[model samples]
Target: MEINEVQKWIKSYYGQRGWTDYGPFIRVGFLMEETGEVARAVRSYEIGRDRPDESTPPPEQLKNDLIEEIGDVLGNIALLADLYGITLEEAFTAHKEKLVKRFNS
Candidate 1:
C-alpha cells in the first residue's frame, strides 16, 4: 500500500480502539526507545565481529537482532508520521530534495 493509505489505515485502526491522537512526547519516547534497540543491536554485532575467535553469539542471531531493531525503528517512524499527519513518502521526498539541493549548491 501507499504511504498515505497506510497512514489512513493506522488512523482508522487507532480511532476504532478509542485512541484519537498520540502526543509529541509519546512519539518521541517511542522513537528514542527504538533508537536504543538499534544501538544495542549494533553494539552486539560489533562485539561479535571483534571477537570472532572467542565465544561469541552466532552470526544469524546478530542479523536477526539487527533486523528486528530496524523494524522497531520503522514502526516508531510510522507512528510519528501518523501523529503529525505526514506521509512517509512525503517525508522521504522532502529529505531527498533537501539533500540534493544542499549538494548541488
Candidate 2:
C-alpha cells in the first residue's frame, strides 16, 4: 500500500503482460488519457451529464467510476515515474518541500 509497493506492482503487472515497451512520450499519452477520464468523472460528479438518450448512472455508480478513474490516473503516473527510475515517495517529498518553501516563506 506504499507508493513503492504500488510502483513495483504496476511494473510487474504490466511487465508480465509485456506492456512495458512504451516510450516516455507514449506513457505521457496514456497518462493524459487517464487524466481526461478523471476530468470526465469529476464533471459527472459536479454536474449531471445531459444525455437523454442514455440513462444516467446512479450516484453510487458515478462515485465508483470516479474512484476507478482516479486509480487509473494514479497507476499511469506511477508507471511513468517508474519508467524514469523515480519513486512516487520521492516525488511527493520534493513536492511537499516545494510547497513548504513557497508558502512558509
Candidate 3:
C-alpha cells in the first residue's frame, strides 16, 4: 500500500478513538517505544536470546515477530509524520534525492 493510504488509515484509526489531538511529545514516545520493540525483535531473530527460561520460539515465529514489530515501527513513524504535517511520500522523495546525490556525485 502507498504511504499516503497508510497515513490516512492511521489518521482514521486514531481519530476514531479521539487520538488526533495527541501532542508530538507523546507521539515521539510511542515511536521510540516501537523502535525498541523492533530492536528486541531483531536481536531475538538474528542473534537468538540467552534466555533459557523460555524455549526459543520456532524460526517462523521469530520471523513473524520481526515482521510485526517492524510494522509497528512503521505505523508509529507514519503517526509522527502525520502529526508533523509531513507526508511519507515527501519524506521518501527527499531521502531518495539525498541518496542519489551522495552516491552519484
Candidate 4:
C-alpha cells in the first residue's frame, strides 16, 4: 500500500481502539529504540561480512531485519503525524513540493 493509505489505515485502527493521545516524546523514544535496532542489525550484517569463510546466515536475513526497522520507524512517524493532526498525503505533498522548489532553484 501507499504511504498515505498506510497512514490512514493506522490512524483509523488506532483511533477506533481509543489511542488518541500520542505524545511526541513517546514517538521520539520509539524512533530512538528503532534506530538502535537498525544499528544492531547493521552491526550483525558487518560481522557476517567479516566471516565470509564461515557459514553465513545469508545476506537476506540482514536485509529483512533492516526492513523491519524501517517499518518500525514508519509506524512511529505515522503516530507522530496522527498526534499532530497531519495526514500522510499532506506531509508527502508538502515535502515533495519543497524538494521540487529546492531543485528548481
Q: Best candidate per TM-score, number?
A: 2
lDDT of 4 at 80: 88
Task: Give the clashing residue pairs of candidate 3, or none.
Answer: none
TM-score list, all predictions: 0.74, 0.95, 0.92, 0.73
Candidate 4, 5-97: lDDT as tens digits: 899887788678766465789778877898888887787787754565756567898888888987777777898887888987888899999
How far in Å is the alpha carbon of 41 misplaced in model 1? 0.1
Backbone clash pairs in model 4 (N, Cα, C under 3 Å; residues 3+ apart or in different chains), count: 0
Clashing pairs in 1: none
lDDT (10s digit) by residue, model 3, range 1-105? 888999899889978988767788988888889889989988988888988797789999999999999888887788888877899999999999999999999
All candidates: CA RMSD (Å): 3.9, 0.9, 1.2, 3.7
Please provide, for model 1 over 1-105, each residue's C-alpha lDDT reduced to its tens digit, 9 standing for 90 to 100.
787677677567667875536687887887798899899789888764466575667889888989989867776677778777788889999999999999988
Candidate 2 matches the true fold with a TM-score of 0.95
Off by over 4 Å in 4: 12-22, 46-56
lDDT of 4 at 65: 84
Model 2 local distance difference test score? 0.90
In model 1, the number of clashes is 0
Candidate with top lDDT is 2
lDDT of 4 at 57: 66
Q: In lDDT terms, how accurate is model 1?
A: 0.78
Model 3, CA-based lDDT: 0.88
